[model samples]
Target chain A: MGRWEPNARGRLEQAALELYVERGYEQTTVAEIAGRAGLTERTFFRHFADKREVLFAGAGTLRDDLVSAAAQAPPGAPPIDVVATALAAVAAPFQGRLESVRRRQSVIEANAELKERELIKLASLSAALAETLRERGVAEPAASLAAEAGIGVFKVAFGRWVGEPGGGEFARIVREAVDELKAVAAGS
Target chain B: MGRWEPNARGRLEQAALELYVERGYEQTTVAEIAGRAGLTERTFFRHFADKREVLFAGAGTLRDDLVSAAAQAPPGAPPIDVVATALAAVAAPFQGRLESVRRRQSVIEANAELKERELIKLASLSAALAETLRERGVAEPAASLAAEAGIGVFKVAFGRWVGEPGGGEFARIVREAVDELKAVAAGS
Candidate 1:
């Protein structure tokens, strides 16, 4: 293999997901995952810290991307709109990855530790989004409130998108979720 | 000590918080907590599964109470209003316990595992609230949206209450937080 094998990370992820689905997350070993990917154990370690890390690595990137997106939103946009713009940016990457996302979610749901980690990731994302909003001159409770509301909308929309894959566009679902969140908040 | 001691559970909780605040959650032991409470280790186990449980016991009670309050909300109340009523119910118990609550929060904030548990508890509360809303003829997305919004408001209000203990009443803070949540959701 060359020093830089193309898509090595993607192959490892694909292999890990398939093994997790076929053999259950608890029973699947890193060696089996690497073998399935036609790569060495070292290659697997190179991509992820452990088996669970493969499922969570994207969360870190997602958090960072989301923070940057919110920070770069227009100078005077409303806080919620800024958050919506940030979340909407993430929908494109998820368009063709529905199956993998579903399988990954199932695996996470099956494990308590993974579920805790998922919640932690989401909480961290909310905190980061709040910090970004604060940077935009938003004040205390409002900044946190808007960021958290954004996360709530994203979570509800993501669940809907995963369960009803072809029902509507992910971005559209997110918009509607935000609107619903607003309506719910408005007690309408 | 008498076997039928009054408020044994409350005594154990108070002792646990004192120990956690003084010695730190990691260094504190169940035996010490029981000792401070003038109880035996067996008595401690009767009330809590472990040392961590001392701080989290109220979560179960809070969940139960919130769900019951939602279920008992006046008929035809909006889903969000039902949630607001449920949250307002919790504010009563929280009064006169600000010091203990502050200590408990500090301990939880000091430990990552405790923080995760806290988030899990809040998420569970949200889920239970959603189910109660569903039982009240509320439909999908709305139930969850209102429930999640309630949680968001509760967290923000709780933070503000803790940070500024003498600022105002908990229920009033919660009300303002809910209004702010509505404003944020509305992109105000």
Candidate 2:
């Protein structure tokens, strides 16, 4: 939010990933990344606040997409459906980019610290979803439960969408996942 | 697993919460906690791995309860229902302890590091749930999805139960949460 530098952001992300792969998240330094990006340390700061920021820097964009989609869903939509639509909207950027998604997940997997941060990010998203549902007049506990359930579905769908060979469409997989939840809840 | 000292374990937990509330999680140390509990730091380590563990050092018991319950759910139980039943069994020890829970939650809320650790713990629980679901013939994504959704219901119910002055019951709230998910799935 401070200094607005467009190209530096992408440059920093790529640089961070390269270093993370070659060295490690802990071993990678902001200064080293900025140098690789042909930018000064301050320039790197202009985009990401810290080394960890490079990993989660796009969370805001995804969060906004999720919230906006939920907001735009039809008036009578249930909380889970609204969250599903939001996840679909957010999946567009990652769709067909399995290699990148896998790499990001790999980085997160190699370190428990990174995994904890990722978990916190997911928790925050669920909280946001619950808040949005509450704003829509959903009752206590339902809004939060529905939001958490939706995130669970998203986690499952995304993991499959990225891990499977020639993975099916991201949106399609998510829709099917939702239907599966419905079936489980209804059928059993 | 180290010292088979049950009362010592309880003492360490009580001391940790007192200090965390008095000083802070980061500021508190294993030695200080042990001293307060009239034990050596070695005894504290013998009971729990470290300072952070004092809060949920009972995870081993909780896990056993969950696994045993999941192992025993009716063979034909649905994925969500199975997970829900397991969660209910695991939450039994936590019943009638709302005041203690609210205090623990406050300590967690005050510390980001603690919250992060809590998230990691939840992720582990979710993975365990997925594994248990696999033993029941649930497919890959379905197993993970059902597990995560079950965690969702647990979180929502636990959140409400602890916050309510006279929450009906932990198991009751959990069932209510599952019912809400069913209603949402069928609602829109």
Candidate 3:
């Protein structure tokens, strides 16, 4: 392989997901992922720490985007609205990648350990959002509540999107989920 | 030891928590937990499958209580209200167990594996609540949204209750948390 591989990280992720889907996650190996990507194991390590990291590496970037979007929302808006808007904004990246996202979800769902890792990532994202809300002058309980509830909306919305056969818009589903949560909270 | 030990289960739980808090969850062994409770390893195994089970055994009963309360909620109430009412009802069990709950929380917090286990338990509880809401005739996204949001409220409320210097009523805290979440969702 050449010293410079364009989109090596992307290729590794694609390869890893394909392999995980083909051969069960437990049976898949890092060497197989690297070889499938047409890259060396050393290059794979450069992109991800382990086989599991291939599935979760995007979570860090997603959290950063969410926090950034939340931090930049209108100052006087309600914490929940800020979080909702941020969540909607962050849904853009997943718009055109429905199949890959669905594949990733299936892989994660098939493995107990991956499912736990996904939950931990979601929990950490909620914590980060809460911290960002606090930074925005939102008080405790409210900030935490908004952050967690917002994530709850995302989880439901994302699940719905993945389960949809037509592959609808991600942000639209998120908006609807947020509205549903708001109505649910209002006891309507 | 006598063939019959009164409150063997309770004693094992108490001993496990103390040992986990004192010597750390990683360093504590099943043998030590049994010894601390004046029981044998056989007794410990009979009560719990393993050391982690000592901390998580109550989750099953808690889930049952929450699901039953949710199922019995007024037929005409909104999904979120049903969930909130059930959550408050379940808080009754933890009213006088603040110290032990806080210790367990600390122990779980100190260990990554335990924290992941705790997250899995919470996820399972949310799934159960969602299922109960579905059985109550609530629709798809709405059922999941209410259940997840309810769990989010519980997480924040329980955190506040545990963090308080002078312990407050768990049910009251849950109600207040539910109200705060409602206000947040309403963009107040």
C-alpha TM-score for every candidate: 0.96, 0.92, 0.98
lDDT of each residue in B1-188, candidate 1, tens digit only: 35687788889999999999899999999999999998889998988999998888788889999999899999999887888888989877897788888899999999999999999998999899999999999998999888887898898889999889484689888878887877787777
Better DockQ candidate (1, 2): 1
Ranking under DockQ, best-scoring first? 3, 1, 2
Q: Write the per-residue lDDT of candidate 3 for residues B11-65, one digit (tens) a residue.
A: 9999999999999999999999999999999999988999999999999999999
> Which segments of model 3 are wrong by more than 4 Å?
A1-3, B1-3
Candidate 2 Cα misplacement greater than 4 A, ranges: A1-6, B1-6
Error of 3 at A118 (Å): 0.3
| Candidate 3 global TM-score | 0.98
Give the top-scoring candidate (DockQ): 3
What's the lDDT for residue B82 in model 2? 87
TM-score of the second chain in candidate 2 = 0.90
Q: Over the full model, what C-alpha lDDT does candidate 2 score relative to the true structure?
A: 0.81
- Model 1 stretches astray by more than 4 angstroms: A1-4, A165-167, B1-4, B165-167
A5, model 3: CA deviation in Å?
1.6
TM-score of chain B, candidate 1?
A: 0.94
Q: What does candidate 2's lDDT look like per residue over B1-188, in tens digits?
A: 35555588778778888888889878888889999988888888777877777777766677777778987999988887888789888877788777667778889999898889777778788898889889878887778877888888888888888888786678877887888878877764
Looking at chain B only, the TM-scores across the models are 0.94, 0.90, 0.97
lDDT of each: 0.87, 0.81, 0.93
